[model samples]
Target: MKLLLLNLIFLSGSAAAVELNADGILNSLIDEFVSCVNDSAGPIHQAAMRLFWLLVPINLVISGIRCVFNGDFSDFFFSLVTSVLFTGIFYYLLSHDYAIGKSIIDSFVTMVDDDYMGPSELIDLVFNIDRQINNLMTSNVLGLVSKLQIVICMIVFSVVMFFVILRFVSIYLTAQILCVIGVFVLGFGGLKATRYLAVNYLKLLISKGLELITVLIITKTGCRILNDVIDATKLYEEGLSVLKHSECMVMIFISLFIFVLSKSLPPVMSSLMSGTSGGFETGLGLSLKKYRFLISRNSGK
Candidate 1:
């Protein structure tokens, strides 16, 4: 009987060790995959950036020609200088690896760390829960309902992370593509349509930057609130057997918030960028309307 008990104990310990090793290997593989993707993408990004700069001189010449035709040397010179300056600034940012999307993500991460609600904490919390579940499984203490809840939470967490990461990558890639194409097209000053396209593209770049920041802010704020609730629940858990239920509620709330933010943030960002309330529309519309009225009056005179 003693020998049988010893054998069982040894087998259990070995099984647990194997499981942990498997998890570690899986995590390492994921890290390597992400690194590989970043390395592969670097050259493509650089090429797009280079092409954008190459088109700047062409755009300047076209703008100069258009201005000369309009008999507006001052406007031509002003546009030339401003366009060059903006292009230079963008070039500096791109060359120095200060990509707007990456910068916003890093800044938000830093802010969350300062507020004691970093993503690392969330990751650790999830892993800890996973560990607990594993232990329960080994000890035969995990009920069917408890196992289901754990599985559901894990699935939800994975889905949220996957979609969030996908959206972020899409936004970053789109911004890069737009910056290249938009700057190149801005050279075609003779086409009124191209000019409008260029302006809209510029607005789009700004919108992308704003959208990233807004999403990060919302996510971080949500995480912080969730963390606070979690901490409060821990205090209450000492006197009650409601920890699992509390955690379930918290996880559900987090998942819902993430879904809502992902679905709603883009539209809010677009509206903000449109300047419907003291933005580009209000200023530009009023200015253009007044300019047209003045032109009509002058023509009548």
Candidate 2:
């Protein structure tokens, strides 16, 4: 039994180690190595590797500032990462001849086969995707309508939350304010007697207000997140329009495509063209030489 197991292991390992064709293996290795190098380089090219590394701290600082103002640091982080991933995926789909679209289609078919989400669920997902896509090409009038909707909804929701917070905060502040007024009304003798009492009362009120406001702002932003999707739609439209108007859309796409194609095409085309040109030059040289030799022979004879 041990001998059979050992033999089986050895046979499997040997099969796994089967040699690949020299040229094919070399080409594949080079393509993969190039991709690895580029991935390691991050956003910029090889020359800016250090610069890109430096941007990491800068990005963190920016995120911190955003968090301070918005108080939704977690949401900010989520949006940042999601946007980067989405843009990278979109750029690949638009620029490359890698059949990314076909892969997406295949995945949908596979999902149906796997009985993951039902057809109705898939249809709802498609509708949401359509809404997002349509949101991009949407006109300013439509954008205004959407923004208005968000504004009204957020304003209403934020007001409700703010007031709920305000009610609690007001109770504390009102008590403190009333006590302060009480001190003034009662005179220095009364305040001196109740100094500790007054300070404690004010401290409690301020602390409660701080806590309530923090919760209120965080809750408000959380409620506004769905509306911010519309904001994203507006931003995307502006960015795409700028690229389109600048006539750089095609160029940008081609530039990105070349990054992928650089692995496969440039060297191949260069070699093929060089060989073809060399052959043509050689044929022309030979023909000219043969004509001269024939002419000389005829003249001498």
Best by lDDT: 1
Candidate 2 ranges beyond 4 A from true positions? 1-179, 182-203, 206-233, 236-301
Report clash pairs, candidate 2: none
Q: Tens digit of lDDT per residue, candidate 2, span 1-301?
A: 2232224333544444333432233223323333433343223222222332344345556656776789864546553653344334323322332233224323423432343332222223323433654554354423233554433443443334323333323332333333233222211111122223323333333333333333333323333432443454456566643212222223233223322332333234334323333332235446655765686679679
lDDT of 2: 0.36
Q: Report the CA-based lDDT of candidate 1 relative to the real structure.
A: 0.52
The sequence of per-residue lDDT tens digits that candidate 1 reaches over residues 232-269 is 54443344433364565566677667657766886688
Q: Rate the local accuracy (lDDT) of all candidates.
A: 0.52, 0.36
